[model samples]
Target chain A: MAQLLPSVWRHIPERYSLLGSHCENCGKDYFPQRPICPTCRRKGKIVQKLMPREGKIFSHTLVHAAPAGFELEAPYHLAIVELKNGVHLLSQIVDSDSEAIQINSPVKMVFRKISEDGKQGAIAYGYKFKVVRNAAAASKPGKPVGKQSTSSKK
Target chain B: MNRSGIVGYGTSVPRMRIKVGEIAKVWGKDGERVSSGLGIIEKSVPALDEDSATLAVEAARVAVEAGKINPQKIGAVFVGSESKPYAVKPTATVVAQAVGASVHMTAADLEFACKAGTAAIQACMGMVASGMIEYGLAIGSDTAQGKPGDALEYSAGGGAAAYVIGKPAESIAVIEDTYSFTTDTPDFWRRQHEEFPEHGGRFTAEPAYFKHVVSATRGLLEKTGMKIGDFDFVVFHQPNGKFPGRAAKILGVPDEKIKQGLITPILGNTYSASSMVGLASVLDVAKAGERILMTSYGSGAGSDSFWFTVTDKIEEEGRRQPESVFEMLKDKVNVDYATYAKHRRKIKSL
Candidate 1:
């Protein structure tokens, strides 16, 4: 708990809202935020920037061998998503089919639980990307009301 | 930022679900019987990473984004949940920070069973109406739990809803009036360290949910001089598909009034977010100038009744989002019982 809490606290902006840094000079974006731009050095004008919530899949892989903490979530899809500004971040793909995941597929960010320290430890939350099934009208409104599956009355 | 109305609204339902039959099979019971008895098909299952806090954050983020309201003006944040991730810490703070709300705001977590969400709404109304803040974010969410074979396992589900309350002129719906009725009827409760709650079975009906809900609703009608037919829509705490209808019957609200808001059959009982999500559902398709009546019940027990008048801003550009209640309901992924247990942490490996 002690080791995990401090790190999560320090990276709240990045983890919660995807706050990163963008260099105006070299026109590059960074995750985990960089104080000094490597390309332009001191001459670069770097400012805090919020990465876009929508991106495209640059590359992906199927991880059947789960890590120590993520044993329950074996055989998951891990991908590197390319943001709008060309910044790429490695993350897990969730709520999508293995066949549906392809390079350059449009995806959107969603908040989700990342990991927990252990039994009775702090729960960490961050963004995960999902393949976009439908960008417009995920479901239509003003449909006549109907029973989903079960009857209300006995 | 006019007095006390809903400026922004959003809802979140986890994509994963476990059918009642899957759960019933594990317990060696008739799946069809249990499904019919509870009036539920399946319930939303939180992914391994989702909990009360994550759900709240997602819903609140959508509320802020959909309404196009600047988070800097939000003055208070109140999260209502019985399934908070941290017992000693406040989930409201996590939500406030996630949405980039200003630091100079009051925040806390509240609990009172399913109606806790409405309680938070009432608190925000008072604060905004009294000039304590410019705007307040109220959230209701839960990752409800149940014992392996308990009846609650059939109906308990996970979801969240968030509302941004501010002046009526800037709101999508103006909250006309509100009322509450409370009594020490202990029909259902969970002790300090208990994981799942216990209920009084049939006693949960007439004397608890009906008594408080009916009383508060009737009291509101009497106080506001409004009758059942004056409301175009009615929403009640949906612990199950049958309970809301039974309560509405006692209140003289027609079945059509409950039709638009009764989503429990598909999503199950979202606990604190139950009635609040119904309000969001009604707001999704309600015409401007339409009237809505809502009542929420928490089983310790008490009920809160509210009246709303949808404003023209509801249909205005940029105020509404694509993530409607109906859409969240449609976006679902089916999972088996073993996967459900693993995702919900019921099969802990630590």
Candidate 2:
């Protein structure tokens, strides 16, 4: 817990939220944020952009084998999501049927416990995707608040 | 002092539920009798990765969005829960950062058993009313735990509710007044380093829940000179489906008056989130001028009661977006006892 605190502290902003960096010059977005834009280099004006929480599934895989600290959540689905901003990022798909998961399926982000150190350790939290249900009634994937707000009320 | 009011509210219920029958079957008890006795058909269960902090953050995000206010402007954040993720660290800080609250703000974890969430609200009301802050975010969230085979297991559940409080003019519901009744009657308690809480059984009634609820409620009604008939809706802390009804009867309130907010039968007791969630459900369908009375009970034990009047802003702001409590309640999947155990950590790997 002690050794992991610093990294956890540093990543709290991005981990606890769906924050990405947007390049004013290139109009491109990057998840986990980027200090510099590769497309426009020094001329790029980098700003923290609140990324959309809804997206379409690009691809997915099932994790049958458990990793350290994730044994209990074995056989969870992981997918590369094409966010509304067109930034494809990898995240786990939870709270939905495995058979229901498919490519191009609409997904939305939710706050969930990602990991914990142990009995008395700090619980690490992050955003995870879930296959959106009630698609026909779905208004739209998302609406960015003031341009940078995360996800739609949908 | 500036008047404080509820600008916006949000709820978070996990996707999983374990029916009373599923849990009762594991203990060889009659499922029908157990559910009928407790008036709970099923209880919400959190995912393996979900806890008080995560669920609280979910609710808070919706509230922040619904309030249409910048998170940076929220001057205080208080999370009330019995099942905080970290024992040493503050869950309020996690929610504060998660909601993008300003660095120049106050945040803390509050505990008062089930009413802790309402207590968080009262604290914010104080700070806001005193002109100390423009707005405050109060949350009640819990991934409540109960011992296997214990009576509480059938009703203890996971859920969260968040309320963004600001000035009356900016509120969707104006808070009229609040009252509380407290005493050192240990109806329920979890010892240090204990996994589950212990209770005084029927003692939780009469001397604990009832005493506090009735007293606090009548106290507030007297203070405001409002009659039971004046309230269009009433919400009382429900440890089980039966208790709220019984409390209403004792208060001379009609059974139907609290029917809308009596959600414990479907969602189980969300602990600190209990009454706050109930109030949110009522506000979902309440009209612009409707009056509401809410009382919350936490087993340490005490009751915090309040009066609120819905405003035209409730209709203007709308209720369905970000999902209402009724909507979230409908989006659920029932898990078996084994899966429930695994999720609740009743079946730990070590």
DockQ per candidate, 2 decimals: 0.36, 0.23
Error of 1 at B118 (Å): 0.6
Cα lDDT, model 1, residue A20: 98
lDDT by residue (tens digit), candidate 1, A1-154 = 5576989888888988899999999888898699999899999999999998889999999999998878778888999999877889998999887877999998888888788888678777888888887767663454535432222211
- Each candidate's fnat, in order? 0.40, 0.30
Per-residue lDDT of model 1, residues B1-350, tens digit only: 22599999888888888898889999999999989888889999998878999889989988887767889999999999999999998999999989999899999999999999999999999999999998899999999988778888888999999999998888999999999999999998888998788999999999999999999999989998988778888899999888898888888877887887887888889999999888888887787888889999999999999999989998887676466687777778889988888777776462
Off by over 4 Å in 2: A135-154, B318-321, B348-350
Identify the candidate with maximal TM-score: 1
- Residue A132 lDDT in model 2? 88
The i-RMS of candidate 1 is 8.0
User: What are the lDDT scores of the predictions, listed in order?
Assistant: 0.87, 0.87
TM-score of 2: 0.94
